[model samples]
Target: MKDSAVAPTRVDGYAELRDYAVIGDGRSVALIACDGAVDWLSWPDLDSPTLFAAVLDQARGGRFDLRPKVPYTAARRYLPGTNVLETTFTTASGTVRVTDALTLSDTASLTPGRELVRRIEGLAGSVPMGWSVQPRFTYGAHAPHLTRRAGVPVATYGAEAVAICAWHAGQPQCTTDSVTARFRTEVGTRALIALPYAYQEPLVLPTHAECEARLDHTAAAWRQWSDERTYTGPWREAVLRSALALKLLVFAPSGAVAAAATCSLPEELGGERNWDYRFSWIRDSAFTLDAFLKLGCAPEATSYLWWLMHASQLTHPRLHVLYRLSGGTRAPERTLPLSGYRGSSPVRVGNAAAGQLQLDTYGELLQTAWLYTTAGHRLDADVARRLAEIADFICTTWRQLDAGIWEVRSAPEHFTQSKMMCWITLDRALDLAVRQLIPARHADRWHEERQAVADFVETRCFSERMNSYVRSAGSDDVDASLLLGLLHGYRPSDDRRMSGTVSAVEKTLRQGPYVNRYLGPDGLSGSEGAFLACSFWLAEALARCGRTEEAVSLMDQLVALGNDVGLYGEEIDPASGAFLGNLPQGLTHLALISAACAIGEAAR
Candidate 1:
């Protein structure tokens, strides 16, 4: 942690949490500052209006910030399976610890009208403590009217009113309008800051005596969830943490998983590559399902596949690559004028790229459905018809130019990976039809299209000079996306072309454990930090190519990139190893879990 002089105002803004860590229930998440403030969170659910808006606009964004009244240093981590966060602050007077969590309701549905608890305990000598309760509403555009209800600070903005209060207090006032509490505490002195809805049914807030038992319950719950993981491998802890991260993104009600929690956190800080990742992307979740299934988290795979089936039945001309976490079809693109993260403008909300035709999605969809079928689930006739329809659509459209997986905007090309995915769709559809004895009207047509795509990829997509398959036909540039072709079983990993492609990726895209998605600008300006997941896929490909040692070494290097806790962002700067984009990124963690398990199996 770097030392900066504290002002009445927050010293650092947007990127401040980049140094902080994340804690969350599977339904909602919060960011905790190292100084012990619970800064950003979407209450009730991930999609709900935030109670702590300070994370987006620190000056105006409200936060539930808690810290030592005296200057201090701090560090924190999540308690294993649970989303509980324990951050310890060391002051010159003494060391104090604060544990934060939202107690999981025994009921299935969650209401915002529930309690969120923050427990602060004195660990050593006497230390003065401070708590600031600022509740801004509507993304920091409005201030809530504050009142005292049953001795708790309750702020009402609109229909939604938030209660913010200090559990233990002794010291004086800074302003009549603000809720600030400052006090000194001796060893073993404890406080509980409980924030519950003003209108909810009255419930007993946990007492200081009950805090320890509550913490124990949180830890036990997480352990039980983690014990269900069947991966008994060398990197079990890393794999389990990654699985937990993926699970954290799952929207509990519908089983749809968000691609990442945040929207418009840039891949390049000041670049235009920022896109809202809060929506569910079929392509992303397909790989997520594969990762979960590989680690024996079968329920996650099953739930998400059900969500995928519901999403695919929508009547869009081309299926959206991404949907709202609630399966909403319309994601209108818009931008915010607020000062972006590190002056990175315009902070975007809904993803416009959702409407673009990414042909690879069909392959991922078919493959994911095939996994469910292979795992002994029966497919309904309507779903089988829809699968055949997707295959037929790909057979007709695969020859046309479309946005490739990277969502390049200038002009679409005959991307090798996109074409290979078409091969996967056809191959999987035919395999399922034949193996499962389902009648297929388009089997011969799908097979014919599949062969043509393979022939084209073999002949035109390969670069003789590069000695590997290039990004697309008529281009010598290679892509990291093509590395997954072998992993998807489109071709034998030991094939001469597959081996050469792995070597080519190492030469062109490898930057430590980070990998670039592709070489050469595809009508976009500026460069990005190396993508973490593509690099892992490359490692998995290498392991399949008989390079097990190098694969394991790369996995180790990648795992080391996680911040003190087992979490990673979307990308890492090769020179500095700083996390970029969204925190606790789903794609990066899912790939890590999959690659580690795949390499572990190879070692045996």
Candidate 2:
């Protein structure tokens, strides 16, 4: 081993949520901070156990650091039309540029064995840099043993293995704990580091030059893929960035998109609202498909349809609200031992909402099938039958009380949003049947039930005193989800009742341009940041209601709220503008895309 002459630099306790940006290779993602420390990453797959999770527990959670040793100021941005992250650091001594990416193959598939490439180039005078590679498997439950194989440092813990290769003037010193290195680069000098992970397989070390070449190829692939996006409307940059973020969450092998890359990033700091979002949520996927289809990206929509069909096949054609990326039905929620983000204890894995009877899911699934057909993709006979069965199930069960779209932990209530979505299921299914995309077995019954659902919601969910729809049949509280009524076609955007609900939402849920999912208790103790998606929904609703000027103003503000890299988290603190909850959240990105599209259409 090389001499341990240089001591490791200690990073500050934790990075602000907005200070991190994500890069992925379709299979997994990494959260790299502005200071060039990789604080969270999961290899092999998005749902896989985290290998580096210092974002949650700074002291015990592992990380990989690669940054200038001297004090420096940094600025970062994504390469145009790609997920490649580039951060430039300037110090009194010199300047350096670091480019990071989870390399993709030439065919745009995730590179085999899940490789991450980081390249550092000298921009001017010589700059000293420090680096470390540490792996803590299973959320810090297991520590890997480090050794050198073929002159490349490898870390192994049970069935998992990862190899780190570096192309630098100085050699890395491998201890049992980590691999550390220090080096200086002068003008025209360059260094490359690649880390590839494997499960129950031997590590394959690649030359640093080969890894550097792969980075260029990956960036080209991303640019090519992004060029296929069909949205050329207002806020195009924001829309494209959101689309790219959604692409990062997709498990390419299965076409199942994770709701977000990380789990247990608290919705509220020091709160218990944190839950795993790495699995595919039916509602989120349905909305994602809608956004992709609107952008003329049919391939992603088709891939999601296949994933849904396979998942339904495994579940006997019965749909759960969420499912594992591999099509499994079980997702038992459990708390981990590690300290949560910002002292939020009992970090969670898996989601209990999978078992809840979320009535909105049927509408979402049927709507997705309708979108698929509209995109000119023919559904196989089995898939068609499965979709019909799902619609049939919703027809019979729409009257029952269940969890609402927010996935409340309280006793199921007759949420107005659920009823509205049930109405949407019948409406979209009727359209599909009329188009002959599927057999209209219960056309008359569906028409009848659809009207009945509308009447029931109008009667039971509306509040006379408030002159708007309430959260549920009896409750008088307003929910941001009610803004979706216009988007779902539950009522005309100009209708008095629909307009009344908009007014109610603005009055109760709006905190400037942000909106809370709900003000009432959600069977949880602490408060959460304003849900970013709900605010976008408000903007869409406003545009659809012919409030185009107001919508455009809000759109400008919301678009500017994104991080410097044009990414959003699940929520944002209204007062401080700090990101809260999971970074690069899919639902949030989808909503932003939808809002931008709505604004564009309204403008035209």
Candidate 3:
């Protein structure tokens, strides 16, 4: 086995997970360090046990660090139309190029044989490069034993086997870790490193030319798919980046889209609101469908709805707010013992709030269902029945308190958002029933309940004291979600009440330019950064309300909050406007695409 050129040098923890850029195969993803470490990756699939978990804990989280032996600043980008990641490190000595990608299986087979190909090419002066491979299984708890087979280093952990090898043009033996390799690259020198999952006898290694060809094909595939996007707008690049991010989150084989790639990144860093977002959410799906449709990305919408079709068939008493990526219904929550990112304690894996009764989901589901059916797709009878049953359930349960949109753990109250969603459920159901001329068994009843709910929002949700819609009845605090009331077709955007609510939200919940969901104390202890999705919602609502100029400015600012590659998290710090929370968030991208399309169309 070859060793890294230099001993492992810690990065002093300066690189936060937020600073990392993402690259992924359609099946799984890897988070690469700005300095060139493949820090976080899962094997076999997105939800599989981690082969590199260093992001959660630098010491125990197995990391595959490949970079110059000397200090260097790196620049990275994804090759057009592909998940291939290329990082160029500029050092005092010279420049070295590293490319990373997961190889596609050429034949029909399944095993722990996922290959992570990394190629290093010398572009300038001679530079030394290093490699470290540590396999931490089960979220950094178990360490694997390393051995050499046929002169190639392979790490074995339980049922998984990861092979690693390096080839450099005319370079002799360097140093070695159990799996690490070291070498030097000068001008005109090229080296290739491959990590292949081996299931058969003597895993055959692809030649350098074969690797290059595969990389080219992958790039072509991505560009071709991206070219299908017909969005021509002011924020075209940002929208494109967001669309790409959404594509990355999709677990292609299963047609399941995760809400976000990683879990528990924290809404407020070090706060208790940290929860897993790697699972698929019903609401996320509905919203994502509408967003994708707007961008002319119909395949994602069709695929997701099909996934929802199967998911809805589960025999549970009610649908979960979210589900596992592989369509698994069981997501029992457990805490990992290791310290979390930046000491954010209680690192959790499975989501516990999946069973919560979020009344708002009905509105989203029905609204998107209506969208698909209106677009000439036939409604599944089972889907329609289940949907109507949910509407009826909301009709009966709307008056009762449940967890609101934020999934707050406090004993449920009559959250105005929940009530408004109840209104939506009835509104869309009645609309669909009317369009199809089908008997809405309780059309009049649903209409009456919907109006009653609307009236409830007017009377109880709005506060006379602030002259704006409050978070809920008897509370003076404003909620940003009220902005959706107008956008969701509950009221005309020009309605005075909505205008007043928007102004009130601006005055109270708006931190500088960004918006917070609520001004009231969330039961959690720490303060949170401004919610980016809420700010984007404000932009969309403003556009719908005919405040196009203000909406455009706000949208520009929100787009600027994205990282260099055009990804955003849940929140942004008002001070520096830096992104926070689990990054490449589904909600954030969905909002960007929808806002861009709405603004783009309105402008035209």
- Models 1 onward score TM values of 0.92, 0.96, 0.92
- How much lDDT does candidate 2 score? 0.86
- How does each model score on lDDT? 0.75, 0.86, 0.74
Candidate 1 contains a number of clashing pairs equal to 2
Task: Give the top-scoring candidate (lDDT).
Answer: 2
- Model 1 clash pairs are 54-61, 81-222
Residue 268 miss distance in model 2 (angstroms): 1.4
List runs of model 1 lying over 4 Å from the truth.
1-11, 14-18, 107-114, 169-178, 197-216
Q: Model 2, stretches more than 4 Å misplaced? A: 1-12, 107-112
**Maximum-TM-score candidate:** 2
Q: Give the per-residue lDDT of model 2 (tens digit) for 257-313.
A: 899999999888888889899999888756888887987778778888899878877
Q: What is the lDDT of residue 490 in candidate 3?
A: 70
Off by over 4 Å in 3: 1-14, 105-113, 169-178, 198-207, 315-317, 437-439
